[model samples]
Target: MGVRSLPAEAYYGIQTLRALENFPISGLRPLAAYVDACVLIKKAAAMVNGDLGCIPADLSQAIVQAADEILNGALRDQFVVDVYQAGAGTSHHMNVNEVLANRALELLGDQKGNYQRLNPNDHVNYGQSTNDVIPTAIRIGGLLALERTLFPALADAIATLDRNAEGFQAVVRSGRTHLQDAVPVRLGDTFRAWAQILSEHLIRIETASGDLTLLGLGGSAAGTGLNTHPHYRQRVVARLAEFIDQPLRPAPHLMAAMQSMAPFVAVSGALRNLAQDCVKISHDLRLLDSGPKTGLKEIQLPPVQPGSSIMPGKYNPVMAEMTSMVCFQVMGYDSAIALAAQAGQLELNVMMPLIAYNLIHSIELLGNTLAALNHRCLQGIQADRERCLAYAEGSLALVTALNPHIGYLNAAAIAKESLETGKSLRQLVLERGLMSAEDLAQVLDLDTMSQLPGDT
Candidate 1:
């Protein structure tokens, strides 16, 4: 937007330089993944435009070659625009356009900054606008990261929990509701519940991301398709689907797609749900692995590091604690995304820079944290069978087994006496001759106590 001394070797041009000077917020550049996504779109567009006779085959081939080099991560450091730059990711979009245009000029034997031969606006960004392309790139980048990172990490965590569920089946423990023991349950039951939560989170992610299959490509400035060939949308989308290996389609109403951030909001909501599930599972693991001597000590977590420098033998559930913190951060990102999604004024959302940064960052953070949690903690967790059974035997709520036969009042009386007398619920029931020994044996069987009421 202003006169400037261009860097002698920098591939980025005046627009990217202006962005760097203006928006220094966050000190973080747009992610390499986002840049690669943008380049992939340019590559596909160039191939399609050349085939449609809209652009010269030689120039289109050069553009595609530049995009390929960027896609394979040849010049990642050239994308210097800050992620917190101008809204709708204009700076970020122009940053990619300039980089690709200059690179294409190099491949064509033209010196850098020779815009007359390969203009960033006229040739490289032929049929696209920042309004449509930026958001589309965000979605594509997110989908790639989800498949290659987050989803795999999630599956690892779930499989770890699944294995522990069956492995700990015989470790009967006191079940707590509201932090008070209420009945007996197998350790497997707790893990199974956590697995179920993650499974549901996965389903929600699938359902929410299904909306992203429809894209706003070909929706040029204000979605009017100005200066673009009518068939460009269909051909480009078909090319993109084949390249992305995902079945994607153009949105029916280009203008509506360009203006709405609803799909992004839905995706962020799914991430939030997954984060909440992580928070709950992590908190439970932290509580269960609290203290080897003084706290619950019902389960032992593999010690990854020294938890405290001042205390001896102080091993903490660091993985689970870290997971909890990561989840909290993801939840915060979800809230920011929700606000940004709502901040969409008529044709564009100015908060998209934040949206793009937060969503990809949240996904990457969650993926890494989950993999660490699974490998460092869940995989090596050992059930404290003796401690679990000890607590099960000591629980006063074991009188719950007698409720079916002795009635609630009588059972409550036995429960109260067992607490006051420092005796087991079985001992109190036997002392009062409430039932025959044979009947009591069957009612208080450890395996039977761990079963659900329906099973009993």
Candidate 2:
């Protein structure tokens, strides 16, 4: 207030203005999840403080109403602090406080930036500190994202994969070891395997997110719950839980919640694992859809975009490629999270800003990427049945089925002869009178070799 003349209409006061001037690092501003979470947390803190008689009821009502407007997407653009700003997200916390404070003052028929009427720290952020408020907001942001976006998207992916697995059960294809044909396997096995892996990953992500339910709302400047009532932490968390409809509990050791960025690391690590799986699945899809003429061409990926600038009728596995890129970004975000998680000195982690931004970004990107991939690429996939069977029937590993009937040496000799004479395995075996046609047919069913071929 002593520094310079005020903007008569500046909703965010001196602190937020200072942050905007200090950190111009990222052109990007804090996103909706974060801003919304901040507003929601402020509202909850005001309600709890009012309940404890720590703040006047009229002021509490004004703060809650102003914050609700922000939560409903009003004045969000006023939160203009860069995501890469001061550590522990103090800048963002102050940004939210100042905006809500000024807005509440206006609501109470006072001019904006009139701190005497409604101070940011003393009124809106009454019983909170940056340490507790920032981390609590981050948790709320992540929980809302996972519950509202990521989980439902993954469910759709799982359903699509399962349906495809059943549809492709009869498409037998050559399985390779070291890029060489090793055996025949049902094409559906690949889908089923991905479905199972993704399902497990979803469970792991959810389990990891469960840790966020424990928040550090009243842990004040440090983890000591300083300047707050004994019942403050419990009541604030209860208010948050009722408002968000989440099973939230006050963090047992406030120090642990404030100091350790371990929870964000754990959730980010879970996301990294899921991203790794997505990359693998996407790569597999790319390989299967490699070529229509010169490559494997065992399956066809949906041709959403033209593959090349020069080549005509060329369609690339762009969605799968996109999935891989998004997954890799998630991995990179995980590395940043891991580094930020370790930056805690003693009482509180100073890297909360990085952790919060990356964690929220990764969840939204991964979920949206998978959802689009399932709908645009995976669901429209088709198997090249004739190509799959041809590869399976012609594969050198078809000899493995004959290995039991014929000695290894004999099988080797037959394989060599077939290669030299340009003969099929069946033709070479039958020409040598090694087995009758009926017997060979029974033994060399490619579908059965693929996986005990139940029906086919």
Candidate 3:
């Protein structure tokens, strides 16, 4: 490559400069969590290399200090490589290496670009290859996302749903199947079921994330562990585990770990599963809160902003709609991750940057979407008690209660007559003498009909 000059203040070096000029792709930079994951790896490596006598103590100290500064929110803009850079994330890897190496040089009273005293490849990225480091960073980034964002958001959502369920427990409503009234149901139980759905998704996601704990760090170039110290694998993993406070271990087969993107695929698939549920829940909210005059109106969602530009006083289920959009994005990201996972050749997966971005971004996106939905929508949801009761009473499905008492054929005939004559099912049943008024009252009681089996 020809000589290219970067700004005097730039911490990134020539390789990064080449990358910047070459890959002017998506303006998106590496995510904060992704940056943190890479920096953590550098810090752990520096500490371990220092102890193992692989690098000089002073240089290792400088590198560690530089990494700490990045972790503590410094020099973030220096990671200027476009996300869609060279395959296997080599460009971004070098970007991180250059920034840390140059910063380390500065910390040692040397000028930036002084690779003689502390080089990026020869020192900062010592004993590590992009193949192993990128994959491991994806894992750590996923873990960081789960711990810092998704898990907490999920817990909050589940709690909010539980609270809503308890509050709306007594509101009986019409239950629709196939978009037609089928039976009576308590509105609260619907929220409870959603809570349970999210809880189960949480379990599945946690299970899928378990594979991320196994790493391919010491595998180096091609999982051959070439040029790596004998103790580097275990020691580095141990150091990383301590650094992130997670129990990480070396993969039994480093080649498989580096070569297969299964862990990322699994995590993304789990996110896809969760996203599907989120879309379902969001659509349900939208339907329940459809309109004030023309739609179901079984519930009211608090309006965050005016929904329509031309129509005045029009507020929509914006949070739920936003949730569906984010979930759909997660599904799309999962698809990309699956394709990337399979596209890898023998030794390395060249599609790692795509996987890394999509997987981690999906987690953070879904997490933020859920948090917004919970805070702005679910928490403020107000059930329409009068509407719920009216729907429960008016639904033709109420004839279902007459089956055991009067018989299925008789109930069907009553329902037909009620629809034809524009009369109520109760009126038809009473006129036809299907059952006594007292018995009919007990059978058609919305509270009793919608109550769960164990409810008092």
Candidate 4:
């Protein structure tokens, strides 16, 4: 049989076969992830049918069993194809359906590809179109990736930084604005700010997830619900909710669902925000980890690899570097998603091929990057306690904390004298008799200084 005639196979056409042979990057086959998604979709589809009283009980049981086998990694051997093709993932979708159908037939003691007894398209796919199924699967996969991987890793990072804040609460460091020293802040406060940023990102992620939850599954074909049963929409969504263990609602308007790619763009935007935040944090970490000899050396990053081939004993912040790269890739993916979103035409978006690719890549990359950052960077972070304290003690900015207790002119004079004479502010204050020893100590105390009248 010609490759085109064999709908059961992935690389049936010479063009497809050639593309598969040429694109050897990511040695991992394309169908593995798709098949996993397909398995979930199939389970969801069957559950939807079962709920609507359309599927035979025995058939539903068989489909569920086959889905379990695919989920447990039994059918990956059959999924040998590249995911980066330009055909809108039709072949990819069919490949998954064929694999599941054949597997389901096997469970029923029947031959593979026997569409007469059990068709991959008619039975396995049911009312789903690649348009609906592919995007739905992308959302499902993205949600799972975030819930299982990204959120936990980010939560770990927040918790790690929170603990670091508590541990370094007393260790004061110079706070910088526009890359210049501005004020003295506790090292804990700096880490707390980072933690809060990540916490806000997590909340944004949760909000983006709501967009993913609004799926277009029942919008068969061009989102007009053509060829789909009247009741199939709600049934499939309810089933998907149960199967995926996440609440998924049908798009209220099928035409809107079919014609727009805004949800994907929204997801991309959320990821971009997260990636930008990561880049900011990584940049800060890189600066803070600058040098052991001549640079800020504010905090030491956990060294994962050698900095250079010739430089001996030089450790680079590989975790931070890798995270920054991931952020860059996420930004690129966001651009791809934006381009793909623009590529949507009249009735349906034909750019799902790239949209799915970029969406999945962004989710996986963000998840993995967060996991690595939490484990390699945030977990081992430590403050240079004495160095931080020394910097804070030497800062002229601390004079603001004393200005209310001693008038501004006196405070400025004391700060000027201390800076010129290289004397501690406390020493200068007491020596000049600007304040008594007890008064100077009280004014300099961080709590008392922070609460002094007119400080806020």
**In the order shown, what is each candidate's alpha-carbon RMSD?**
1.4, 1.8, 1.0, 3.8
Where does candidate 3 stray beyond 4 Å? none
On TM-score, who's better, 3 or 4? Answer: 3
For each predicted model, how many residue pairs clash, with residues at least 3 apart or on different chains?
0, 0, 0, 0
Model 3's TM-score against the true structure: 0.99
Determine which window of 10 residues in candidate 3 has minimal summed lDDT: 1-10
Task: Report the C-alpha lDDT of model 2 over 283-390, residue by residue, as the tens digit.
Answer: 999998988899999999999989899999999999999999999999999999999888889898889999889999999999899889988998999999999999
lDDT of each: 0.87, 0.89, 0.93, 0.76
Clashing pairs in 3: none
Per-residue CA lDDT of model 1 for 219-312, tens digit only, reads 9898888867889999888888887787789988889888888888898889998998899888999889877778999999998999898998
TM-score of each: 0.98, 0.96, 0.99, 0.86
Number of clashes found in candidate 3: 0
| lDDT score, candidate 3, position 111 | 93
Q: Measured by TM-score, how close is model 1 to the native structure? A: 0.98
Q: In model 1, what are the clashing residue pairs, if there are any?
A: none
> Candidate 4: worst 10 consecutive residues by lDDT?
447-456
